[model samples]
Target chain A: MRDLVFRNLRGRPGKTGALVLLVTFLSLTLCGGGLVLSSLRAGLNSLENRLGADVIVMPSKAALKTDLDTLFLQGTIGPYYMNMSTVNKIGRTEGIGRMTTQVFLSSMRASCCSIPIQVIGFDPETDFTVQSWLAQSRQGTLKDGELLVGTKVNVNVGESIKLYNVSCPVAGRLAPTGTGLDTAVYCNLNTIRSLMAAAGALGGYSYINGDPAETISAVYIKAADGVNVDDIVNSINIHVRKVQAVRTRSMVTGVADSLGGVSRTVTVLMVVIWLLIWVILLVAFALLAGERKREFAALRVCGMSRARLSGLVFAEAFCVSAAGAVLGILLSLVLVRSFSSLIEGALGLPFLLPSSGTVAALATVSMLVCLLAGPIASAVSARKLSRVDTGLILREG
Target chain B: MDLKAQNISKRFYRKAGESNYFYAVRETDLELPSGALSVLMGRSGSGKTTLLSMLSGLLSPDTGTVTADGRDLYSMDDRKLSAFRAARISVMPQGRAVLDTLSAWENVFLNARIAGVRDESLVPRALELMERFGIPDLKEALPKELSGGELRRVMLCRSLLLSPEVLMCDEPTGDLDDQNTALVLDSLRDYAHQGHTVLLVTHEADAVSYADRLLQMDAGRISTPDPV
Candidate 1:
């Protein structure tokens, strides 16, 4: 039986190749869609955990769209500055538990620093989000003239990077967030202020304008336990002037909503393609079986049982589908791994990949979907072929 | 073992009227004895093939029964009948019986394998049959590579591998040249001489000289068997 099926497959290379190609297309879609969706979900989950803040207060003058990227990607779109007074006011709010401020300083294109990286300045003394993550590396604080590099940054920890004629030591490195943060560099508030003042002295890019040394880009605040996050957000928006308080959930939701549409479209496309493949296979196998009716009947006369003959047909489908699924999975993995950075940059969304175990689980599900497509499509035709009356077929011949 | 068909009949209906019936074979009684070659001859559409089909268990009669060694062929379910036929009878179907995908050797051995012939000499036996059919060198060749005469010989090789008690051939020499036709008839005669029943259906009267018994079919009716 095995020999027969293989011989038939080898004999009709064109038909087998077409089926393999179709199955491969299905597998690629399944794997690609599954990987993208899972990656997006992981990114959003990591974003929620990394924020660790209920309400974020940004300088009201900042463009809403750019501010959204600033909150999620740690990206600075132009210089948006609010007086240090806004952080103080938010800190004193009724439901505020802990509040910390971040200062954004852009690197000059020709500056001594390593290519125009987003320099995020955090208050290590009072920070909760990045500081907590840094605890995993057993790092306590970012001292003066020290930089913390994100995973995607070219600089390695213990290496020195020149920032505006001031050499800063790469003190620590953070794991990948699959967002703009991967390329961003981090430092304490004092370091960024020093860099700004040095740039000012050199008559270059400067964030400090005139007098007050205390300038902040955004205030990250955690609401007190059991307090309504939305209420805290609304209270800060109403009470704290010169700053707009946005709930982290709302920002994440905005990106999630867009991603949801994309994922849904992919899902619908997958289903549509699956049905199309099935219908095509059904028709194709039916025609194939019709053409081979005399051959099958002759086999029957030669003592090939109907059930075994049907099994032979199914076996052929399984072999082709399995091969196609494996090929498509490998190709999809290559495509996803290659374009992941571009995907993140284009979407400007926080993209975190799940662990390896989760990826394997997702791939398995996709492979199963692809593998089942062929046999299911050809089942009806195979059954009909098996039960064909040999006597009539022979007499007709 | 003897092949017996008793009071068998078959009818076809016109497409326009369900009540209208055309008898392809009617009230046919055939007893093909062991160790003899029985040839059924008639013009095209005169029910020779239909009667042969009934005898071969390929077609079920509208009435009466076919039995071998007192076991009713039609009474058994499809599976049992198929197995019985596969193990005990060799059927040489009309037209090409070789699959284009398989080599000549594989085609010849296929029936023996399906009939579960597990003898150690199976390969040699198949090769011997090929040699006997005068196409031993064509073993590795696919059906598409063979001529019509060679294809017919390959089919005979396949049927002969079963070593069945009953053998049925339908127009085995239809496309063969005179030499190939003589080769095929000689093989069938030898098979019948080996204590097996051989039934051959053809419109070619030239084959009558090779038969031990001749049966005539016309207009869905068969005459009594006459010794040739």
Candidate 2:
């Protein structure tokens, strides 16, 4: 039986090759779609956890000026300014639990810095979000002039980066959040004040008497337990002067909606292609069985049992499908890995590859589906061929 | 083993699920006993092939029963019957019976392989049969690479490879020249003389001369020639 299977596959080059190609197409679609969906789900789950704050109060015009979701996702708040008094006023609000102030500054693409990057200056005493993330990689408190780098910062710990003529040694690198935060840099408030002084001396500082201590960019707040987050957000927006309050869920909801649309389209496309492959296989096998009726009849006349005959057909199908699966999996992995950044940019969503085990599991599932496709599609024709009237087929010619 | 069909009849419907049908082989009794060649003669559409199919256990008759070696052929399950055929009977079908994927050598040994038996000892015998049929050099050649005459010989070699108790050939020499035709008919006669039951159907006059007994079929009915 093995001999016969191999002989058929080797002998019928055209049929075998065509079947393999079809299965490869199916596998490619399954794997590629699975990866994209998995990556998006992972990114969304991570995003939800990363956005620990309930409401962010930014300068009123900053909401109109910046893409808020992108800002939250990337860790880059615009260089918007509001009085430090705004943080105190928001802290005194009725339902505010814990709040932290962040100052936003931009690096110059001058002789001092190679690339322009967003510099986030977080206060050690009042901060909430960055501390937990920082603890995942290190234990020591962040000291002045020592920087924490994001995953995309490209500088290693202990490496010195020049910002506004002041050199800071990187203390640690944060884990990826699959957002613009990966590319941004973090520091203590004292470092930003020094950078601000350096900028003022360099004639680069233009804003408000160059005073870094009196202003803050945004205030991240967590509402009190059982308090209505929406009410807290509304209170801050109404009572707080010259600032806009934004809920973190809105950013998450926006991404969730986009992910929902993507999942629907991918699901539909996968189903349509599967149906098309099945129909094409059914027609192709029926025609192939028809063309080879006399040969099958010859096998039957040679005393090949119906069961054996059908087994032979399925064995051949398995060969074709398995070959196609290997090719499809390899091709799909390469395509997804290579184009992930492009896929992220195009989808306008945070993207990250799932773990190796997850990817391998997807491949195995896709392979099983591809393997079953050929046998399932070939079932009717195989039975028909096995049950053919030997004498009649010979007589037809 | 003897191959026989008792009062067998076969009808084929022109359309599925329709009452309109015609008999391809009418009610008749057929018995091919061992040790001699019995040839059935017929013209086109005369039903010789239909009767042969029922007797060879390839087709189920509409009525009556077919038996081989004292056991009802149709009564046995497909597995048992097919195994019986593989061990004791060989059927050489008419017209382009070679599996297109396999080489001539593989096709010769196809019956034994399909029967789940790997008789490596048949290698020498297979080559000998291929040599006798003048297709020895074409052993590695695919069916598409062979001529019609060569293809017929491949099927013939395959049928005789197992040296079963019963042998049935239908128009086995159709594509052959006169020399090859005589060669094939002589082979069939020799096969029968070896104490095997040989039942063949052909329109060739040369085939009738080589038969120990001649039978005639017309419009799905059989008649005897009582040929000397």
Candidate 3:
């Protein structure tokens, strides 16, 4: 049966090629679109998981919370800083749990990659946000003068990154967060202070105060259990002197809504293309029935049962669709993996390719859909041709 | 096995109107006993092929039964009837009645393959038949690469590959030259002489000398009777 199917496909190259191409198109759209959408969803989930802080308190001049790290990717975004007095004042407020501050500093030059890597300085002892995320890529803590690089950082573990004439050895690499954070570097507060002092000696006072230890950029706060985070944000906005408190949910929700809109548009487009292919396949098979009527009649005369003949047609379709599906999924995998960075940049949102297991599951579904599409379209033609009068068709021909 | 058609007739509904009907084969009784070659002769539109279709169980007669060895062919289910046809009957269709994709050898064994007969056992028989039909060297030739006469001979070899008890040929010599036509008729005669029931439909005069019984049709009925 397998030999028969391949032989028949080889017999009519033009028709078989057209059908296979159509199926490949369907599978590519279904699988490729599905993977991109799933990756976008994964990006959002990763952001929500990593941004564990319910509320972020930053200087009022900071218009966007995520822009704090965006400067690492894009140079022109201005950095804002508030005095440490604001952090202390916000910590003393009610309903605050496990608060930590991250200082933002930038270096004018770095030999790591094209863009100047953003240097984020965090208090190792009181840090609650990044340590948990770092646990996935490496163990232990970030020691002084050692750097924890993001996944996007060209430097690898145990490698040295020259920043501000300070050659910092990379202690570990962080797992991909699929955000602007992936492009940044993290280190202890003492190392950042030295980096700041080094920049200061060079006449690069990119921070608010000349003293790095006295100024902090943002403070991440977690609301205590049974306490509303919104209330904390509202209180910080009103009670704080010059810092604006932003809820992480607001940032995440905006991203989630955009991802949903993009998902819907992609899904609708994929559905339209699939539907068009389905209709074309139906018409193709129906016309094939007409063209191959005499051949089927000949089979009937050869003592082939109606059921057997129909099964033969369906089996041929199944083979072509299977070939098309496997090829399409492979192409999808290549295209999605290769252009992931561009996909992320174009969307201006996080985009992460799904894991191998997740991709396999999606490919299986797409292949199954393509597999069924072929036979279902051909089954109609099969039945129509199988019922044809063998004697009449063969006799006339 | 003896082939019998009892009061068999076929009618086709024309698209001119729902109530209109055209009789392709009228009520008729016929017997094609074992060990004889029967030739059915008719002009175009004479319902010769339609009657052969009913007799071979390819077309269901409107009223009557075609029985082989007292077993009604129409009464059998699709699977059983197909098996019966594969085991007991083989039909040589008109025109280029070969699957274009398969080679000449594959076409020859197509019937045996469809009947689920293993190819290894039929290799000797296929080789012998192809050698007899002078298509042994054309085993690898596709249908398009073969001439019409060679293609017809290949189809004949295909129909004979399974060594069925009943062989039906519809215009087997339609596209053959005189030499090939005479060769085919002689083979059909030889096949019938081997105690196999053979029914052939053709307009060629050379077939008359080879027929053990002659049947004639006109306007969907056995209008003329002749003795061969």
Candidate 4:
């Protein structure tokens, strides 16, 4: 019976169209679904991997906001100045193993291009997280006036790039991290302070005009091995006047939650899209089944078992869906890779390529959908065909 | 095994004004013995095909029992009945009931496979049947490519794939010319000679001449042979 169904499914002309349409539809939906899921997973994973410091001390006012408005939402950052004095104070605190400061110099273009790039200043010797990834690709230590470029950085190695009028050599390029780090340029804190001082920018150190300064914007703290991060943050909040301490885990959760609405919206939209595709395919199958009513009646009188007939219908649908799913997945991969930059430009958000797991899941779902659709449509048509009197038709013919 | 329809009756309702019920086949009793060829002859609207359908177990009578090989046809579950038909009985319905997508050989093997008799040997067997029927070249031809007579022959070959206990054919020779008609009758006669019950429904006298017994149907009842 299974063989019979398979044979009929392969032999039928109408099944070809159904298979093409169903597979095409399912494949497209699956691709979109895979992309969305993969990007979300990659984004979260990157966030987890890049969380180096156990605690971050920013401005208390900025920390209290639910939106992380000062750090991410608005272009304007509040007074989160935990300069040299604050770092020194925190370094001396008991249970503080290490501390480093980072100052975010607003987006600036290199001398080669006009496109703005995010510039971050860090202490190469003290900053462990982002620096380690950079150091792995570096042949040697970063010298004075040298910069480490992220994966997406526009500058080439050995290129002389200017940061606020101070020229620097591009030392090395970081690997793709699927995070904001990919778009950032890492330079020593001294270099940033010197550049800002020469430019006479706001919050710049006047002493950096002749020599490098130790002042910084924000401090990242790592608690001692046995010391709890929560305890350190609480103590810092109590003793440190204006600074804010954020735990690494809580910061990730906060960022994820801040974008919760977008995630939910994307999920809901994907469901709606899939539902719409199902309906469209259902209608198509229904019409196809209707068109083949006479043929179905003929088979019935010819002693074809209902089960075998149903199996044939299912096989036809499955074939169509499988084709569509493969095509859709391939289409999605091409679209995601080729149009990633376009998507980034349009949405002002990174577009991450989906992983193999996502592609496999999409294909499985598409195949199931295709396999299910044929029988449902065929059952409806078969019921109507069964109600027909075969003998009467024979006599009339 | 014999195909029997005992006191079978069927009535359908008329949607328009006056008539409430229309009897398609009423109080019809039939007995088709194994290893015999029987013909059911009737004009248009004479209920010959309906009675044949009831005998074949494809249709259930509203008030009577149809039994084949001592098994009640209407009483069996769908799966059981389907199995019974595929294994014990074969039906060649009205018109060219061949699947348009499958070649003649494929159609033959399809039935054989459904009946659980599929073997690689069935290919040569199918080709032999097609050749014997004078359509040897049609083994690889799809239904849409075949003539009406060719299609009927393919359906006949499919029905005989399992060497069923009973072969119920409705107008098997309706689309054939004189030469093909003779060929089909010879096939039916040969099948009956092999101890398979062959029940044929036809309006043409030439088609029924090969039958060992003849039953005339009119209105909704079969007229007794040598009618009083």
Going through the candidates in order, what is chain B's TM-score? 0.94, 0.96, 0.95, 0.93
In candidate 1, the second chain superimposes onto the true chain B with a TM-score of 0.94
i-RMSD values for every candidate model = 1.4, 1.2, 1.1, 2.6
| DockQ per candidate | 0.61, 0.71, 0.75, 0.35
Say which prediction, candidate 3 or candidate 4, comes out ahead on lDDT.
3
lDDT of 2 by residue, A199-308 (tens): 77787757636377877887888988988999988888789888988888888898899899988998899889877977887788788878778778888899988898
**Full ranking by TM-score:** 3, 1, 2, 4
Separate clash counts for every candidate: 1, 2, 0, 4
Query: Which whole-number lDDT from 0 to 100 does residue A127 have in model 4?
Result: 85
- The local lDDT score (0 to 100) that residue A73 gets in candidate 2 is 57
Winner on lDDT between 1 and 3 is 3
Off by over 4 Å in 3: A65-77, A109-115, A206-208, B13-21, B119-121
Give lDDT tens digits, candidate 4, residues A59-165.
56555443232333222334334456766777766788788778765544444323465566788778876666675687666776788887777889899676666
Fnat for each predicted structure, in order: 0.53, 0.81, 0.76, 0.43
lDDT of 3: 0.85
Q: lDDT tens string, model 3, B166-189?
A: 999989998788887888899999
- The segments of candidate 2 whose C-alpha lies over 4 angstroms from its true place after superposition are A64-66, A73-77, A108-112, A124-126, A134-173, A192-209, A213-215, B14-20
Alpha-carbon runs more than 4 Å astray in model 1: A64-66, A70-76, A111-113, A132-146, A151-162, A165-173, A210-213, A341-349, B12-21
Better of 1 and 3 by TM-score: 3
